[model samples]
Target: MNTDLMINRGIIKYNGNAFEEIDDVIANEYPLTIIVDGDEFATMVCTPDHLDELVIGFLASEGIIRAIEDIAALSINEDRGFAYVELVQKQTMSKDFFSKRFIGSCCGKSRQFYLHNDVKTAKTFMKQIEISVSQCFNLMTKMQEQSTAFQLTGGLHNASLCTKDQVLLSRSDIGRHNALDKIYGYCLKNKLSITDMMIAFSGRISSEVLLKVSKIGVGIVLSKSAPTTLAVNLANDLGITAIGFVRGQSLNVYSHPERIVS
Candidate 1:
């Protein structure tokens, strides 16, 4: 098994001419293939730590499984980084399953693999989680402090999910989406309730991200960057809260302002 490694790079100057050598930490990347009922679903380049959770979360985000219990068994080939999942009962895989192989996005959610129906049911829940701007900054600070990889390599993106009490889980990878998938998988495997949580990403809020959060029933999403217009529109239509450009003590609420407390 490969362990986390630290690498030393050249020097960089901060505040003055004084320079210091930088050291970074990162995990190894491996190809993880997901096979459902003996058929290939999707393959991702991810850290090999959470193959089972990644598979379960990927399936759930894709709308392949309605509930976490719908999955019966998940086997991971640690050596090969392959996962084979067996559902409790077989349901027809999406017709566009093959399409996922080609359509890749920078972050975790893929528009090419979206369901035809709109997320109308998500609009009914009027409950919103109010968080202060400083709290958003604090959460980001916590996320940054938890990112051992970025502190070292500075090449990977990180994603985390947090509740009012604390941050539940975080994952880092070269692909932002893969990081988010890791968190999703973690929650599914641990049987955590996602309805009362908010997701945080180191990337922009695109329609795909909104779609994934809505699918998981997360009421709010916060990002350290901007959001696409489609994402804002979808969040409003689905009654989800979208916060973006979250850095320091500021954030923009692009949709569902009712979720934010003044």
Candidate 2:
């Protein structure tokens, strides 16, 4: 966790019927407005750090751009919390599309069905990435260990990009969508392929999260928490392996159990 992402605040603690005043740190919630071609695309509420990654991931997931070359001009005003972007080819989005995106941009909220762009961009993975049961458990352990922001504020969700054998990158944010966006954006900016990779998450798997993995071309998604019924269904439909309850030695392969060997 970056020091800029958290702040110390005075708080009260009640333990064993005793009240005490203490200082505590809390994660900073930042709302960054994304302006594209001088028009507001959407506003994302997330952790203060990784503004660039957050913007990139959000745009990529929303089917705005497939590669970094699509962006012509990009600048972030962190002090004012705004990201201005100009695409190489200006995209003409319908009013309906922008409305849907604005409403569904937050972490706690999501649209059950795919957006128009999602239908065009969402991937179906027929390829399988094999992982053992032990590997899944170990990966979850590694993700937890790297979730420093969660340990600090206890108010953030973590998202990690990993292979069958090792965790590669981990990002945390106050919003589940933002956390995944951070990692997803990094991959996009760096030109990394996620088709052979997976995501280890600290939050529950929702349809939104599952769809994100699908868009990112990740074959597998592992989470410490449970998966929603809709998420499991979508994962099965998209040919993705959705695993949950990945704690300790036991785990549940909600969909695509075939990918989990041993």
Candidate 3:
């Protein structure tokens, strides 16, 4: 379905001059409530596009569902801010899913209060691709260049998971975390894995970004900015490689420097 809506507004100049009315691009935002097996899960405020992908990705990222086949059916009531997802019979949720809170923070930073010492790695040796500095530059440039919303509003962040061949999924939102979630959702609905995939973002590397990557077992993370201290520590702990300041042919390796050849 076409998700774009149109609005008309007068362009006001910095000099207090108003130009003729023009059509402007507008996306839809609404409250989305997710329901699992007749139980109310969580509600999020998001753009009204890709509802199926959003809910599935949200559950998978939260560790609520392990695989695409685990989801039986999903129905969305766009007018009611609700979605009902029925899981396949006999599937059980991990105990950790009940304890982890659904975070809507722009950075999706994992809460310190919820850190479990017992949490162990769910994946091993996620990526084996040999990447060069120029490849990193091309990826970021492509990710940024594909952000249509950011070009229109100048107020959006973008996230994408790409391969050596092409971009797999890319999303944009007013919040950086939301963009990343959208990309994750896209992957989950499509039954893709973060293993050996490169995640690129147009935001700062915070604990939240690290948590998102860690949850999906993504091997390498590239950002067109800087990372926080906590994010670095988490990346090191999770065996996930992180790269920041990914501009041109240079980047800063905050953790797991071995992943980047040059």
Candidate 4:
């Protein structure tokens, strides 16, 4: 399915004086309702691609499932926009499950409250191998370069899990968190180690983003954006290195800067 919807638009460019009419391709927004064990879990408005990965990663982020093996059955119907999942173990969720997120160009952020499940599942990542300044720059560049969708629609967020040298897996979505989730699911499904890896993101690092990073158990995150105060504090508490504003030649390291060198 072609997820880009081309439409006519009159838009202005950055530092431009006038608007011009042109054909524009916008990333399609689809509502996908995830049903877990016959129960409606969440309805995520997202780019209609990688539904399976999105579902898996969402569940994991919510502290519902840990590994791909934890899912006994899973099916996605993109046309109807539904994901049916059966967990291997009996599942339980708080009564306030409705408080869960419906976040980005979508709702735009995860739930503000830190739930008990998040506390139980979110890990304080251990020390990782040193990442140099140049390595961080290279990783962000590589992640952005791989974001073909963002380049096309200029409407998607990109995320990647990377070793110091290169990106291991990358994903992009209308929602920044969703893109990160896809990368998380990819790493889990591939049995890749999360602790030593870093995430390269194309969005601001908020508390929600930091929580996702904590849950994903990555020690370092690099973004060509900024981080919130709460997120920086959380990163410090969790022993995670949060780097942001990774443009051209300089970057800001928010917390746990020991893991970065040069």
CA-RMSD of model 1:
5.9
lDDT score, candidate 3: 0.70
Clashes of each: 5, 0, 2, 1
Candidates 1 and 2 compared by TM-score, better number? 2
lDDT of all predictions: 0.70, 0.85, 0.70, 0.81
Give the TM-score of each candidate: 0.78, 0.92, 0.80, 0.86
Most lDDT-accurate candidate: 2
Model 2 agreement with the true structure over 147-194: per-residue lDDT tens digits: 777888899898899998899998888889888888878998899977
- Candidate 2 shows a clash count of 0
> What is the model-wide C-alpha lDDT for candidate 4?
0.81
Q: In angstroms, how far off is 9's CA in candidate 3? A: 5.2
Instruction: Summarize candidate 3's per-residue lDDT along 107-167 as a digit string, tens digits.
Output: 5433332333114223333455666677778888888888877666665677888875457
Best-to-worst order by TM-score is 2, 4, 3, 1
Highest TM-score among the candidates is held by which one? 2
lDDT of 4 at 89: 89
Which segments of model 4 are wrong by more than 4 Å? 1-21, 95-113
For candidate 4, lDDT tens digit of each residue in 1-262?
A: 2554222355645448766656566777888999889988788888777778888888899878888999999998877989999989868665365354432241322333456567656788876578999999999999888887778788888889898998888887888889878877877777776657889999999988998988888889899999998888778877889999999999999999888899
TM-score quality measure for candidate 2: 0.92
